[model samples]
Target: MSSDQVKNEIRRFLKSDDKLALCLRGKWGVGKTYTWDALLAEAFGNDTVSPQKYAYVSLFGLETLSDVRKSVFEHTVGAASFRETKDLEATFSSISERVAQLASKWRAGIGIIRGVPVVADYGGLVEAGFLDVRDQIVCFDDLERMSDGLDLKDVLGLISFLKEKKRCKVVLLLNSDALKEQDADDFRVQLEKVIDINLEYDPTSAEAIEIAIPNRSTLRSRLVAEYATTLGITNLRTVFKSLRICERLEEVLKGYDERVISQAFHSACLFAFALYQPNDAPPLETILKNRPYSDLFGNKEEKTPEQIQHAELLRRYRFLKVDGLDLVVFNSIRTGVYADELIKREADLIAAQLDLNDKDAAFTKAWDIYHDSFDDNGEEFAQALKQSIAENAVAISPSNLSASIATLKQLGHGEGTNDIIAAYIGSRGEGKEFWVGDPILPRFNVEDPDVKAAFASKAAEFADNRTLEEVATSIVRQSGWDNSDLDYLDQKTAEDFYKAIKEAKGEQLRLLVYGLTYFRNVGNPDPRMSSITTKAIEALQRLGRESEINRLRVSKFGVEVPAA
Candidate 1:
């Protein structure tokens, strides 16, 4: 079910008193939280009571078992009139009591169930009091931490109590990729009434490319391919996390609350556009969010030297070289000296050897090159291919000159093709070879069978339009994000807010807000650091100087801040 459908289902779930949970699943950059907020809005109209009718809590730092109990206790305290609430006990009894009273209320919205900062047996206090509230709905965005380590006790208890005890509607927003196989399966089983609302990132052909510079498309392709290698992930989930792609993108992505989650999706988009766009830039008021950068995104693979090399091959291109240096790839693992020299000499090499292969002898010559490149050295060829895959060093698609791989295949390389195929994916593009399409280095050989299959999967997803979810789980590694400080799009992410003020009438565009919030704590920030761009820093300086805009309080965007 879509976010809207899930919103509608709340009423049915409430009326039926079904104990099943509503899990909104997808990958990061895919917008599970955004979908949840949309659902929440559908369930509850615009009103301050959004906080009162429903409660919103993030199990972000839920470290120990106590953290789990504490989160539940703090989030649901005001709903009960049980034993004097004080630590975990206050939460337990209060929650138990709240469940008893849930059926009595019908209205709903998100609100903190506030009581004594220190737990006290606090009687239930619904903040806004149901205003035409029909059924209660509770929504959780980026619920990665709360559901981990700890058993089905607290969270399950909360779920169990809400449905079995309280009879209120519940929605758990999650990027499916963040969820491991076990966790996802468990969640699916628990939600019982699972509603799947998969979404895609890249819009249709109708979705015009907003920013167009001279080589902008080329730049983006290179950068994306570069980031693709950095994350060592071909899936979309890794796209957003790619520091090369977004550069502390999560800084503007502020949100734990439902509506805010929706906004963060736009923030992610804003960062992408801002980085790629030229000349015009977004204002700080329109760009930054009030929340801290967070890792609520679950497990992600850390970029390694190899992956970095992978990124380099995808983005950079060589024109010509000085000496005999092979600087064909830059901004990757094997850059600098030799790499830089290679890039500098590419054009010259091609020109100098322009007559290396004569088109007049095309078929025979091309055939000879193919065989000489791989024929006898089977193991060497396989190893070279494997290196290509791992290094993101292979770009294949027929041929470059008049002789393309397609023509060769037509002539039948057979097992020679199969051996080449095995080397591509498993090796992750290790060996550097010829160019085909897109200029990125170590490109996925579309001709390789395994690569063909992987590309097919990506194409299928693209066809299905679910790139957002695809990005979420793509970079995942052993352990997921812990103690997430997510700020789903705050004021800065509301591209719609300043669109009227700047360029057009209601042209929504999120700019970088507090662009360095995630990086501020560093004493000596890296000028050539992996993530920061000189351009982004300049944007921050301009935004930060505006007193009127920077003076805005954190609360406006529904976020908490450190004391000055």
Candidate 2:
């Protein structure tokens, strides 16, 4: 029912004294009881209004009809006297006053009913405190949670008695979805006979959100509602919890712009919904690639069942292509790493914005400053330098390259430092100028032998796949051989080239030797290349192959052969 219809029905139920019961049933957390209580508060001004009594009893663990009877009697008020009273105490006082008046009319030691002695059963009278629930609004909550031994027909029978005999306005607040299979079937069969009105407690989205997040004006609340609706989230508990997470995120992400904050909020909502709702979240890669979003909402032609499910999951959340969020955000949603990285990156950007000097390494330099300030042993400085170098190498920032190189000079022999340096140099063009001058490497370094061989073998493989000139050009560009700081790498490459020729099989050996001769003359003019050419000449001559030697001299190098 619409909120208006439900409201009108509840209003009618409260005002009318008809011998009928109203059943309010819904899925969990859709605010069924909340609505009912709101209505009660509206009608009575407070729960303890005079005379027209309100009783609430939860049948959650009631084991038998006796327990139900006791609960109703205890919860009910103003049963006997029709006069309005302030509280249960006033109602009990009115009953007690009537008893006193009757006691005054009787003799002190004798009581009679139909000329016989009347013995009062005090226990029974106390047990039956207030069963006459005339003019009372009684609610039986958590009906689905009622004990297994308390049969459904039995509970309905009690509701029937409250309406027929007690003349009370009864309401059954239940989550039918939670009902056990047999009980659910039996409840359907039995509720029909007893219930006068079945009002399925269908709360609207706005109503649900209002109940879940009372502070709807806040950005966190607004975003949660928007996201819940977009994702098509209808479960009030999940919505409430998701909004709570957003509230926490808002506090933590206070400094970021709304766009960034909203992104984080949205990501958090996706994660929360996936946890709370029924979904088999696809792998992070699938979401990261936009495949899931595409399969459901994009132009992707082929669709698998898993992809379809992923799409539907997003759709249920009202996620559409027009939302314009990056696919990577979904990845961030699934694994916290993405969001953490985003926050870190944003922090860095913000810090950079606030930094007075365009190049402030104040935080990074703090380590050095601390060591110098203490005049401590250089161990701390050395360790700091090592960390700075390693961090810079992996990230390879042009801004910090000079500082990193200076640190590397002190900690160059640290594990994997050489590889980092090699990779840094290897990434540049052989002729490209270093951002800092060649004195960058104070301690001359040897290229790792494994690195040298791999470079050579890879170059040879490239030669077989492409022209030798192209291979030479590519390696020279990549290895930064022209930079004097990296000349040793050129020499190492030449040596590795010689080893490759010796290990190469017949045709590959011929190609390796030829490629080396061309590299000597046409590639970087390092003397290492000249030495490698000399070695190739000697190796071919030792092979007693004049043809190969002359070919290296004329066909490749364009140099005249010295008489062998």
Candidate 3:
């Protein structure tokens, strides 16, 4: 039945003093309880209205008849009259007074013993407080979750007692799909013997979302609600949770642009839906590919019965497709690409505001001058040369002058670099900055072949003292090259290493290959070595030393050697 028709049936059932029981069955989270409460709210004018007292007791943890009675007593309000009153506390207080009067009257004729009443009726008064269900509406929810010790027959017997004996109107709310197969089979006979009416609740997707998410004024909320309805999300609980996540995203992304916020909304809703419907959730990669939920069923053969059922459920909910949301856009939002760009742009704006007060910006401005100068602009070249001198004018040792000059020479700006260095040294004449034996002197004098040869000799000498492992580690650290950082390496060094190992025979070669193993563990390289370490393997390949590479691949790196 539609939710409205069910509500109308309930209203009719309630308006008449019928001593019959109604069973409302649906899938979990379709808002059976909410619909019933809405009717109650309408009839009573307020949530706290005690008009025609009612008891709402969930059978979830109740294990016995006593537990059921206790729940009813705890939840029941006012008298059987179900009178119109908005004050729940006052109504309950009046019930307590009435029960106390009943207890006093029962004890009036009893004799006293040692100043104590002959009859103590505290439990009786508490029982008389609300145990009589006649003329009141009593609801039992979560019937499927009732403790196993409480048999269905016993529950039905209690329902019969309330209807036939007490003449109370009873409602039983349950998700029939959630019941175990054997229990469901058993319920066929027992439920029929008790309930006077069975109302099947299958709320439409739109009704579900509307009831689930009441705050639909915001654009994000409405978008999520509409998307949920389109996706065939009929579970009101899931819809409520998804809308809440969207609302939180709206607050978190308040200042973000619309595109970014919309992206966030889709991602957040999908994540929430995944949590709520884990079994039906599509694989993340499939979702990212924008494939329909129906695609989740394997095409290796014909669809299985379970797959067909899931497909039908998806069809019913309208969630079978990518509908109204693109996976690529959702992925961008999920991965924060737009947010990263916005952060970078914000950083640039802040740097502009800080101007020269930002040290990082000042250094960047210095590079801008060098960049323009290296591009063949005479005026920029002169300006860069002038700035280089002033930047190193304080007679500072290891100044920025040598680094900028080296960079300029690396860019093929030999004359410009020489001019900048000359002006910097002239400004620091006869000072420590112009030390004749300074380490920075050779690095800056790139135009001199002697200086270059001398530096190369020193580098070769350094490499000779350092083992291949140490060299590999130094290169890895300096270049920040991981195992995955492929396609880049020093060809000359790799070639030299290959030649060195080739000349070494027996144990010497084995020890030489041993150093490459150290790179296998540098900052988490799993089975493969780092890029600098892989350079060693490449060297072996260059010299056709497949045997050695194969041995090292398995013994040290835990990887199989690739086919030559």
lDDT of each: 0.36, 0.59, 0.60
Instruction: Residues 1-564, candidate 1: write the lDDT tens digits.
Output: 443454455444433434455655544443445434444444334332223345555666555545533444345422222222333123445554554354234223332433322223233333222222223445555566554566533565565555555545566666555666776677657655333222323221111111111133443333444333332332233343333323221232222232232222223333333333312223222233211122245535475765444334323322112122111221221222223333334434543343333322333433354477645644444334333323331332332211232443544433354444444434333221221123232332345444445433333332223221121122122112111111111212333222321332221212222222334344675432213323323333333344445324323332333333
TM-score of each: 0.29, 0.56, 0.51
* Model 3 Cα lDDT, one tens digit per residue, 266-287: 5556655655676656545444
Best by TM-score: 2
Candidates in order: C-alpha RMSD to true structure: 33.1, 13.8, 15.5
TM for candidate 3 is 0.51
Q: What is the Å distance of residue 102 in model 3 from its true position?
A: 3.5
Q: For residues 31-125, what per-residue lDDT tens digits would candidate 2 score against the true structure? A: 88878877766666533332377678899888987888766765654433223334333345544453343443443435542242222532243
lDDT of 3 at 129: 49
